[model samples]
Target: MSILSLENVKYSFENTNILNGIDLKISKGDCVSIIGTSGSGKSTLLKLCSDLISPTSGSISFYEKDYNSYEPINLRKQISYCVQIPYLFGDTVYQNLSYPFKIRKQEVNKDKIIKFMKKLNLDESYLEKGINSLSGGEKQRVALIRNLLYKPEILLLDEVTSGLDSQNAKIVQDLIKDLNEDGVTVMWITHSLEQSESIFNKRIQIEQGKIVKEEILK
Candidate 1:
């Protein structure tokens, strides 16, 4: 089943075009890896799909309906984006985890939160710890957990491990792999060739605002 489809999608900033005449389809539960050099428009495509930015031309549809048909807030809940840098707003981990819940007007599921932290090898005590006090890896994991806890139908990852140390990068990498295996549809913008070949079944290569090549890994 196709969950996302972009038809003749184009985006531009000022007079510079970022994406042009792009057409693609992402299936349900697909793990897609988007690869390209910096400024090749890979991230722009992800943002377009996530509705962070709209296309200058063409259309995007989700779940067989126009993406614009869904409310922005609710659409984000179903299709969440995790940028390269971790953005944690709260003073404490507890507050961060509660953010998703608060937005949905629902109570935080403490049991699920604890389980999620444990999966990331985080100590329970860290829940009360300040976000500013957490290490890079810890903050990344918390940011990831917050989005996952939002229960998004699709996940858009934008080079999330690029800024982390080897060990920290592995943690985020493994978490994403695990999530994909567990049936989440993931579109990851990554620079790692090994990761593209190993984790993703489909790969999209972009160049100068166009999808120049596409391959299905065996």
Candidate 2:
């Protein structure tokens, strides 16, 4: 069964349409890349999936259920979102990572968090470091790992590698590929064609808020 589906989804701001008649189906474990130029509504589409905003018209369903039927918080927890620019809280790295767990009443898995940090080339000592002390790349990695630690069914990434250096970007790309291989569905939006081709199994091109082409890379 498809994990997520959008049926003739449309979004508009004022009178200008941002997304028009977008129909998509993402099955479990599918690594789909959304490629388009700036202002093409790629990020908006991701936001809509996460319930950050509602579409102006049309319907979205998740796991064969209408999106509106689920509680907003529950819906968001099942579909994690990582933005282009990382948003770190005014707290320590450990606190930031553990916040989600606290809200969900899940126990903090310190060992697992440390292991994930090490896998991403982040030092264990960073757990106590203030969020503002880290560089842009560091923040992005931390944010990415935080979402991954929860093992959401679907990850919605919007230009997640954009702010990182080439090495860090490659690390993130590889991680996404690994996640997809592990049966996690990924809907990734990126402006980098090269990265899109390398990391995604399927490519969906969007132009002016509409899907222009859908290609299977592998």
Candidate 3:
């Protein structure tokens, strides 16, 4: 069975239809790149998949069960969603990163976090830096590292590398490729076709809130 399935899902905002009948089945370890023009409902679709918003019509199933069947907190833990402009809380970067462990009652693994930071070109001292002092790219990297602390079954990203430079973007892409190889299902929305073609095995094109094309890439 597919890890996640969307059957004729639709969403609307104030009587304006944002997504109309989207059907998708994402299998385990599938790294799908979602691309489309602006206002084509790409982000909205990710939000629905993440259970951040309810679908107006049709159903979404996770692990063969109804998506809403699980508690919100538990569901969100398994299906991680990272938006382009992430929201980081607390004073220091350490606080933001440690919350995941705190909620799970697991001890904060500073060594692991530091390792991840090193991979992202962030040094150990970054843990003590204030969130406000970091640039947009830095904040995005920290938020991503925090989400990966628990290694969710699925990763839903929306233009996560948009604010980064070419090198940083490549770093993020490489990390995602490694995670997908490790068996994490990924659905990433991006405007850069070049980037999408390079990292994803499947490409989905959306237009006016509906899927226009879905292709398996080489």
Judge candidate 2 at residue 187 and give its lDDT.
91
Pairs that collide in candidate 1 are none
How do these models rank on TM-score, best leading? 3, 2, 1
lDDT of 1 by residue, 1-218 (tens): 68999999999999999998999999987899999999999988988888999999999999889988899987888898988788888589999998788877888789889998987778789899998998877887888888898567899989877767877677777877888888789999889998788778899999999999999985
- Top candidate when judged by TM-score against the true structure: 3
Give the runs in model 3 whose Cα sits over 4 Å from its true position: none
Using lDDT as the measure, what is the rank order of every candidate, best first?
3, 2, 1
Q: Which of the two, 2 or 3, has more lDDT? A: 3
Candidate 3: C-alpha RMSD to true structure equals: 0.7
Number of clashes found in candidate 2: 0
Which one is best on lDDT?
Answer: 3
- Stretches of model 1 off by over 4 angstroms after superposition: none
**In candidate 3, what are the lDDT values of residues 64-140, reduced to their tens digit?**
89987889999999999999998999899999989899999999999999999998989999999999999999999
TM-score of candidate 2 against the unseen true structure: 0.96
Stretches of candidate 2 off by over 4 Å are none
lDDT of each: 0.87, 0.90, 0.94
lDDT of 2: 0.90
